[model samples]
Target: MQLPESQVAVLEAASADEATSIDALAEATDLPPETVTGAAFELEEEGLVEVSERVDETIELTDEGHEYATDGLPEVALYEAALEAGADEEPVSMGQVIGQSGLEGDAVDIALSNYARKGYGSIDSGEITADPDAEPTADAEANALEALADGAVGTDDDLEEVIDQLERRGLLEVVETTTRDVALTDEGVTELMGGIETTETVGAVTPDLLTSGEWETVEFADYNVEADAEDVESGTVHVLRQMSERVKDVLVGMGFQEMDGPHVDADFWINDCLFMPQDHPARTHWDRFAMEEPSHIDELPDQLVADVERVHREGLGEDSEGYHSPWDEEFARALALRGHTTSLSTRYLSGEEIGEIEPPARFFSVEKAYRNDTLDATHLLEFYQIEGWVMAEDLSVRDLMGTFEEFYAQFGIEDIQFKPHYNPYTEPSFELFGTHPTTGELIEIGNSGIFREEMLEPLGVDCDVMAWGLALERLAMLTTGAEDIRDLHGTLADLEFLRNAEVTY
Candidate 1:
């Protein structure tokens, strides 16, 4: 790998006295900031220098690492000693062997095991032994035996000899007379360390070490290091989160006070007060996440309950008459995962504080709503909804439509069409649709309308209350070009997918 000269200079200039930032190194070495940083990272991977804080890219090294710069140990010796030390003990774990042997963590585990099999030591379950007489079965033999017991037939004299040797050295002992355990001897440690010394003596360091005159050299090796990759630039926020924030910003900008509510709600506020009958089809298992705990509404206002009963019994002027069924107070009190953020709006409207509020009060909420729906490309079990209410003497359906258009325009969606729709809660309700830029397909984005008198009268909302809401996930999916809802939160480490995603607005 070719490294920039600046990076090479940084490696050479790194000292105990002075540390340099990537910016400073870039200025001194006449390289771009990015280039200097990249070079520093490359040098770091080569084990020549250490980089701390990539934001500043400070270069430093551990004290022992400094010594490695001047007098590097032989790789063979390092491997052998690691194996021997590991084998000499009760089979020290590979991690412990690397730590004790002063070898790099990567490749050392495999190297030590190879050395053990070469008569330097034995490795089993990450433990190493260096005793020559230790009857540590080679990894291959042990694996073969395991495979045989698992219904495979394979045998070799060498494997038998290794087993016998292990038995003779008393390294192999029966545990509960069922399984054999391999133990290492003290001699194994000495042999492993001796192997390192022998290997190092046979050409480990460069000749320049003996007669150096400004000699420049590069060492190349590969090993797995558990280092996090450089952080790459990517757009901020998920599409849903961005949409939610935008909605909140717009509502807050328009003098609307945000309201918070629990995800679990009693059916009373969600349905009964809204004039929805207790036996409404929406209360079925297919429509909601019914909760077992706190399955009762204990503190509904008596006046509101009586008003709701009146509305359900006699259609509050919208229809000639209500269904007139007995209001099932128990059913109305059942707990459920709120199906919409409008539940918060409804709750706020029903409270005494809402009655005391000045005319033209506005409120909004962006929260997760739960539903029991089969997973699909455009559907999710849980999703965010941007719900806002405008309660004023003059709030009209046109105002709601204008708000929808302005909010969607923030996401670069210009064309919006509305179709009349039936909603028990709103008069002149309309389903809003937006054209998908790529597919040119019209998609229903959300629903909006002025609150019906039957729905608002009991809550003391006397003026026209216009509200509009949509799922945030649908917006994000369209904006991010995410074909699957799951892609919004990637499952793998490939940052390129996120980096390459195009954000229109």
Candidate 2:
């Protein structure tokens, strides 16, 4: 059988009668370690050789060990230097002894401490004195370094004790390395005895060869279908980001136009315009993250500002009675990180940028929001909020329920229940819940209601408008089938879950 030069070289070097390591084969064939390994794998796939792997524990010298192997051990060097400096008469200054020994940095401390511990010398008050009768002989550590100087040393009872001491001193390191042994099969022996021939074969077809029609004339190497291959790490969108894009597609498919707004906005657009009173519990310091820089905004239109103030101070039309406590324009302009993306909806509905909102105008935003929430299994300080609103000349509670049914149906969530709820801005509000696919427990998904006139008139949206705000992460949790919210997205998210997660419908 014909083979490439590398494979033939490996076959000739590997023995049929005895197992030979890949390193030994490489040495015999004068090839690189990686080349020898690849050749062995290819030969093994061809049934001409067998490769066996064994994990070997090797003890080798560290940087410190190499230094000690060349120069004497730190303690031995200090003892010799101390002996020369003083003949048991005068104590040598530690600084002078360190300078004479040619050691620096931590080596000086290591030498002095070991020298005293080994009974070779005494260190007292910045001075060192060598023992009078102590002879300069190589310690067990020095002998171990010599044994390992050539390469790795095998562990034995005698050498093990020395290894322990050397390892404790950080002079040696033990590592586990997988070594592959290659042995020729009977077929390989027969082929070698039959005189193996090397051939010039193309391993890969190049574009030039293909274009020139030269590949047909050249002999191609036989493909080893069972050979080991390198691992591939292809680029992929982050799981959370992929879910966000899917959400955007779903919304757009439902005829909702995407909306964008600032992450930091004035309280007027965020809370005040939403009919949240100035002294509402949600606006307190413990609930919201207030920004320090660019402290406030002052560009609100005078008429819109006055309209919102009037809604909060008095009432909107006859059916609406405003908060009736107080409304402060200064408080409205105060800047903070938005607590919800509804701030964007409020802006679009109030500002003329979206133009006159005729019936059936739908706007949605999937954007980030910030809060002062403690991080846990169910809460995160920052997350994406899916905020949306639908406007029509005449709408009812049934319209809101039908919209949610159609929206969640796209995600394969069929069972939904609504419970009567109370919100400051929605007159007849309801909390939306979906039965968890795995847990069988009803989970609160979002809150929705028909916008009260007090909240809508300030935004200049006169028609019936239904608004809802939901957590994007919660939807992602359902899509990815995550048990805990943290497993879907957070600092503590499960990496394995993200790697293997395939977002379901």
Candidate 3:
């Protein structure tokens, strides 16, 4: 294949200097590295050069390439030169020259026509001339005059001139004519350049140069400094953190004490104590990230273990019989990154004073949790959870529903529905659903219900404890219209979005 002119130049430079690397040849010939390498490969393949694999690649042009390289220009350049010379000296015949030169048919015709029109030559009797010496008349004016002579009434100006001439000859009569022109006086010119500075003493009032009084004044009204004005300051809170805090505040206002726990905990507290079966699907490697170096709780208090075993093996009096598999103490002791905020609730329930608290001991927690979930528009592998629980002797499912209704109403989520859902821990469970304003589709916000005796009995809590939670990422998506879960992390949490975003009450 014929290489670009630049590549040919690089080949010549490489052969002359005995360059070893394509980079050196490129620098010497001022060509791109790719161009030098490609040209060198082509030259070697064509028997024009011998390439050797030394410490650095080396290339040498063969005898044939050397001979061609010494020539003034390639065949293409020669053809180009001939075409340019023919175009300048004489208007070459389009058909004959195109046949003789073997150039593009359209190119030859265009060159001949362009040169002829520019007075370089003319196409006379199908042959070009160098001395056409065409006239200097403007093409536009010539076309216009031609049309006017043919009674085409070229333009409005031309038609108006013809009408004036006709009226002068009595062939037509003018109904009316008007002309006007405006010009600036010398005073106006001076005023425009330096601006008029005339001033009137307004009761010897001193100008307040430091203030913006001049720009603030109305065009035709007197300035009044005594006008009453009110100042308003924009009030806002950190959006994500504020929302979490607000949820915490609402829970606190309802007499819930805040609960805290570590981000890492053993599976027994998170799963086993909650009555999640050992062989449950959620405990598999696909759903949970099992720690490589698991921390074993080899000596868990015998009382707690006995209570859990009894609650699981027997019916616990509040629910049906639990899974009979021997609890894997080793697996239970393995440390894991907390998968949900509910783990905090379980930790709180494990304390000795859990049962002795007042009738309704409310507790709330807001913290980050991790999972092995695939990242998507509405799902994040790591996010916060707004969780709370209320334990009371008479706390019923209706009370839990009422609490959620009042809580969601603060954010304008007045319409909520529930569907039956099964949670390993919560019996008679229900998944909370909220209506999307735009799509009118019910979105599952979270799950909630009173804790089963099987789950609470293990922790020595005898009263019913109502628990509810919602993923913070889902709430953010609804609030900000952000589709990607990853966007909620890092720098995308700009202050501007938090400050200006409209929050409906």
Give the best candidate by lDDT: 2
Please write out the lDDT profile of model 2 over residues 1-505, one tens digit for every residue: 7789999999999999999998899899999999899889889888999999999887778887898988878788888888879925679887788778888866765776578667787876567888877765647778779779976576679888889777756687878899999999999899999998898888899999999999989998777676557877676677778878888898899899999989999998889888889988788754687878888996988998998899898887777677778788888888999999888888888864566667778888889999865344456778888898999978899999998898888888778799999988897999988776668677777888998888888777778999899877877766667766767665446666788887655
Q: Give the TM-score of candidate 2.
A: 0.61
lDDT measured at residue 125 in model 3 versus the true structure, 0 to 100: 44
Q: Which is the better candidate, 1 or 3, if ranked by TM-score?
A: 1
On TM-score, the leading prediction is 2
Worst 10 residues of 1 by lDDT: 174-183
lDDT of 1 by residue, 1-505 (tens): 3334454455444443445666667667677867666556655555555566522222233343233323332233444565566455556665566676666643343344236444555545434556645333444434433443344533478765654433322223222312111112243233333542211111134576547732334333322366567686756655455556776786787688888887898887777766677667676764788887667657767888788878888887745487777787677778899888788878888774345555668888888888754344465667788788887887777888888777778778778899999777888899988776556677777888888888888887787888877877667656765554545542311244455655555
Question: Once superposed on the true structure, which residue ranges of model 2 sit more than 4 Å away at CA?
Answer: 1-31, 52-231, 237-242, 314-326, 438-441, 484-505
Better of 1 and 2 by lDDT: 2
Query: Regarding TM-score, does 2 or 3 come out ahead?
Result: 2
